[model samples]
Target: MFLFKRPLISALFRRKIQYPKSLNIKPLITFQINKMSTTVTIPEKQSVIYYDKTGGPEVLQFSTDFPVPSDLASNEILVKNRYSGINYIETYFRNGIYPASFPYIPGREASGEIVAIGSDVKNFKIGDKIAYLGNQNFAQFTKLDSNKVSIINVGANATDDQLKLYAASLLQGLTAITLINEAYNVKEGDYILVTAAAGGVGLILVQLLSKIKKAHVIAVASTNEKLNKAKVNGAEFLLNSSELSYDQIADKILEITNGKGADGIFDSIGKDSFEMDMKSIKRKGTIVSFGNASGAVSPLSITRLSPKNVKIARPQLFGYVTEPEEFQFYTESLFDLIKNGDLKIDIYKVYALKDYKTATIEMEGRKTSGKILLEIPN
Candidate 1:
């Protein structure tokens, strides 16, 4: 009887026992099979905006059936972009102020999900959310090198608002952080002037210098409405450029600093504001000329900087964060600032992917202040 009872128990264990449906238990083998079966369907063709020749915003040609990029290099991952950010740099590329190959697709940064990856990619996997800095992002899909991408570090159930914030912040936020830290090494108590202070990078720069670096920030914008936005982000002083000539702005900055001049001048207006920067910067100050919004600065004699012993920099965002580690460091710092409420993302408008031309027009025409974003349709 004991042997028969033992055999019965062994047979019960050997037979596949069906758990009650209420138990909601999945077999290990079944789970493994389902996992292996999971695959992302990558579309062969995708909507894109591209231009064969550089010109105005009118040059951008959008199509619904542009071929999606394929054949990822070993260190690259393919991303299905959810949102893309617009910057003055794209205008540079589009208008031929910055060099690019013909038939160029203009975009510098985007946020997306990894739909596929090359064999060598281990740091990211299918379905990973990421914000990446790369070119040709005005499309449904972007194939990017692993080094340029930062995985979005939000909750498992992150909302669209959270994702959009990261998308809007990545490029301009990193630029602002790197500008203060590397371009000029801003210090607490230093008097810093940020031109275009309510624009995308400008507002962030104001906040970083004032709120994070504890610097006295003088915000310069074309209108009082824009200056007010800058003040809300922590600028201690506001100067309306529309109301003040460059000379007057320079005089005001000097007055604010008690005739000492600003220790650092962050200028994005390029040609139009270069002289103002020279006049407003203190001796041994650093002038970071980062954008060409008012058109690129013309050549100046290096001797122009010698009188004040002022240092000048024409730093680009990519130049400051070339290494993967450097990129990760600044990216993490930016994210932390947002998470802690130290940095606020101000998105002026989010345009449909097809409406990219209008977005670019508004951005370049200074019709908008704050980050401009494009929503990529599925």
Candidate 2:
């Protein structure tokens, strides 16, 4: 499978972009560039971590001579990445479980400043601070389709810490946002269960579901420390997944919910938690399987779902934001929550780009609590 997603606006920008009535996306706010703050210089080559044949983190090689793409499609924008967010899904690609093109660049999300913009780009300009989630990342500099970019206003006076936090938090933060708000439509007074609840996405889900939606959040993690972190983030109840079998986990969930089970169960740890997730949800409750941290869940027979009248949904971020307008709406809303202090970005660790292997090792072992990040040197 091709690991890289094509630029979002690469195809649409060739034609006239239009917004559907349902989206209600405001017109693109074009920022005019007057005197350029600094004439950002580009290097002919940039360092990147790449793997020719995927296997383990050891396969990744850091090369300073990696050639930067000189060609730019009309809708593409070049960003000088300050920080790159790491996700476990990238490890799947690196381990060859997910097919990828040879010499793959394994990063998916980042925050940076726009050093260059294509001629057809309208909504952004040079020096604009932006964060993006897409393919062909894991490098000091990356080119993103204009539509895929999220503008982060880290004005001239912004500090390096502010930029790093926003950039590193984008993927996990936005995933939690869309998952709670759209994937399962969490509402007030619902009982929600989150597997791997102390994880990057899990912590955010706990905060959003409990604090924002007024839902009862039951968090499951492998360690007491993680579970405690979940509690600090507003999880009302906690269970250590490592301490209980799937059936026992289900039983505990039922006890917490007064034998009714959870109204919504979000399972990111797929294989081990699949059975627990099914038994822990109430009739007609929604079960959203978003990740496969433990291992991929096998396909279930329809009869298994019919017995409980439960609804199952597997949501991927790419599928949710295929429409430019919907993507814009979600991105804006997520950032707005951050701006209003309704959400906090909890970053677990930051490593230099050259320390890619150690970073992946920590993430794969589940040693980190929140998002893992790569700090790209300017």
Q: Highest lDDT: which candidate?
A: 1
lDDT string for model 2 (1-378, tens) is 111122232222222234336345454333332222225778889999899997877898998998876666667678888888888888778876689998788888877788877776676667777666767768878876665534443544446787777776677877887787667887688999998888888988898888778899999988899999999999999898778877898999999999999999888888888989888899989999988887789978988888789999898877766665556655666666666677777888889999999988887787888777889877
TM-score of each: 0.86, 0.88
Report, for all candidates in order, the number of backbone clashes: 0, 0
**Which ten contiguous residues of candidate 2 have the minimum total lDDT?**
1-10
Candidate 2 collision pairs: none
Candidate 1, residue 352: the lDDT equals 92
- Cα misplacement distance, residue 257 of candidate 2 (Å): 1.3
Q: Write the per-residue lDDT of candidate 1 for residues 1-378, one digit (tens) a residue.
A: 000101121111222322224224222111011111116887889998899998888889998988888777766778888899988888888888878897788788887777877666655667767667778888999987664434442433555776688789998998998788778888779999999999999999988888778899999998889988998899999999889899999999999999999999999999999999999999999999999989999999999989899999999888866654455556656766776687889999999989999988877777789998999899
User: Model 2, stretches more than 4 Å misplaced?
Assistant: 1-23, 27-39, 147-158
* Count of clashes in candidate 2: 0
